[model samples]
Target: MTEVLVVGAGPVGLALAADLRMRGVEVAVVERRTDPGAGTRAIGIHSPALALLEASGATDGIRERAVRIARGEARADGRVLAEIRFDRLRARHPYVAALPQSDTIEVLTALAPPVRRGVGVTSLRQETDGIRAQLDDGGEIRAGVVVVATGWSGRDLVYRPGAVRTHHYPDRYVMADVVASGGPVARVHLERAGVVESFPLPGGRRRLVAWAGTNEVTDADGFLRDAVAARTGTPVDIAGASTFGVRRAVAPALRRGRVIVVGDAAHEVSPIGGQGMNLGLLDALTLAPLLGPWVRRGDDAGLARWERDRLASARHAARLAFLNTMLGRAAGPSAHAARTMALRTALRGPGGEAFTRAYAMRFDRAARARG
Candidate 1:
């Protein structure tokens, strides 16, 4: 029997599998898709996440394909409202590494246990000694422990026993990667038009995200160009475009019996701070060590502790991401003015350092204690 069966070979599952295998735990990973997703869903990897990846020996490969962003600027009306100098952070990777999520997936998949693609967990049932997962291909997996890292789908499939609350913000945004020449700095513009943000990716490409109000944008290319021009005072060539909603949610619990959840399977936050992937990586980092011990010794107490710590951390991250979305989606002259003033104050004082550190997810007391 497999020591651990991880469902969904996304970043979280892959990271956990790699960590557990490195620790000498037998593991297997399954994914529903035969191929990796082409979209660049989450693009920013912060300092703490970089540290985690470095420990797993994946950061060098990731950095080879990623662009290092040294600073983050907030602008309004073409004026720089606030600046976050990532260089001020004390970590070895003081900058945010901007890489396409596809590349990230590649790096993680290479490090993880061999994945069985086109295989997905259709249902899960807990037995006396382990959890039994029914696969879509008429196969069943019985492991000492099961990890649900299938993102939002796990909310219904795994957590149906309890209520999961999701708060959808009225904000809608369109994102695209375009060919552009800019510094290694990420910028966010909170203007009356909307919130237009840009992050530099590798190979002279930049990712642009712009708020498009409550309505679905019909012309993503046009909207992206106009928003980019309005926010950065520069117009560039568009490569591709997509749209997404801003929402926050948390699972009722991170663990149910012998099965556990991680990543978007357990919590989801806004993309404003690019914390979704980083948080998911942290979840894997946090759970892997505890899970290995629990599976080896049948230590229910250790699993319970992991559940408590991870749940609390997820809630905190979700709240922070919601705040970031609210600040970025703020509109009108007064709202913009208030945001500008707040940013100015926060960036100029000690509060600015705290904010940036928190955004980087380096200020978690539990994480520090664990380290």
Candidate 2:
């Protein structure tokens, strides 16, 4: 039996596998994708998340590939609502960095020992000794533990037996690419018409996620022309585009006997704070220290402990996401006015500084990992 079997080759799966191997646990990563990769997807390496990456000793190269977003500003009608000065966050890295998830998955996956691609786990059954995973072709894997880091639809289908929150909104969040003509880092500009967020890419291209203006990628050439003209004040080419339904969800239990779920498989954070991936990475990192010894020593109690420890953290992330998405969809006159006032208050004196620290995710004395 393998020490651990990791499902999915996404950021969280790759990260969990790498961390386990680094700690001397034998691991096998199973990814059904013929070739797993993402394009123009999430890569906001927030400070707190970056600190976790640093601990893994795998962040330096990824850091170099990312553009430092030392501040995050929100604007409406081109008027500033809130600007978070990340320099004040209490950490060595006090800012957000933008790197595509594709690059992130590649970097983290390459760090793992190896991957079992093309093979898929169809169902999970807990046994007295370990857990049995039935694969697509009726093959099976018995492992001391399991890690589920699968993405949206897959997790929804696989983890339905667990606590499931099917939260969907009619508000379609359109994400596409556009050239950055302004400053570096990242910016979120909101107008009565819509919201537009721009992030710098490791490559020359600048990525834009917008909810307003003419939707592009609906038609490649036409979308490119429309999106480019909208963002850079000139027509631009389409690098990539994808639309997804984002929401909050948590597996009923972080663990069921020897079977375990972490990352998006356990819970999903909405895209508002860009915390989904960040929180998922934290899940992997946090589990390593807490569960490593158990996997190494082959102790069932250790596996049990991992389940209990991961529950609270996953739940908090899911709830926070639910609230953020709820607020992001509301842009009525009153909500906008209230938001403006709140931003102004949070930007002044000590309040602003405190808010900035929180925004940067530098929660002082707050333990982000398992105790």
Each model's TM-score?
0.95, 0.85
lDDT agreement of model 1 with the native: 0.82
lDDT of 2 by residue, 120-154 (tens): 88888888766788899779998888777776645
User: For residues 1-371, what per-residue lDDT tens digits would candidate 1 score against the true structure?
Assistant: 79999988887888888888778889999999899787777898877777777666888988899999888887778888778888888887888889988998899888888999998788888898898889999999999999888898866667665478888888888899888877798888877777888899988888888888888988888888887786768887775688888888888788887888889988888888888888888888777878777888876666677677777777888888877777766477887778788888877888888887887777653446432
Query: Least accurate stretch of 10 residues (summed lDDT) in model 2?
Result: 362-371
The local lDDT score (0 to 100) that residue 156 gets in candidate 2 is 42
Evaluated with lDDT, which candidate comes out highest?
1
> What does each candidate score in C-alpha RMSD?
1.7, 3.6
The C-alpha local distance difference test score for the whole of candidate 2 amounts to 0.67
Give candidate 1 misplaced runs (Cα > 4 Å): 369-371
Taken over the whole model, the C-alpha lDDT of each candidate is 0.82, 0.67
Model 1 pairs whose backbones collide: none
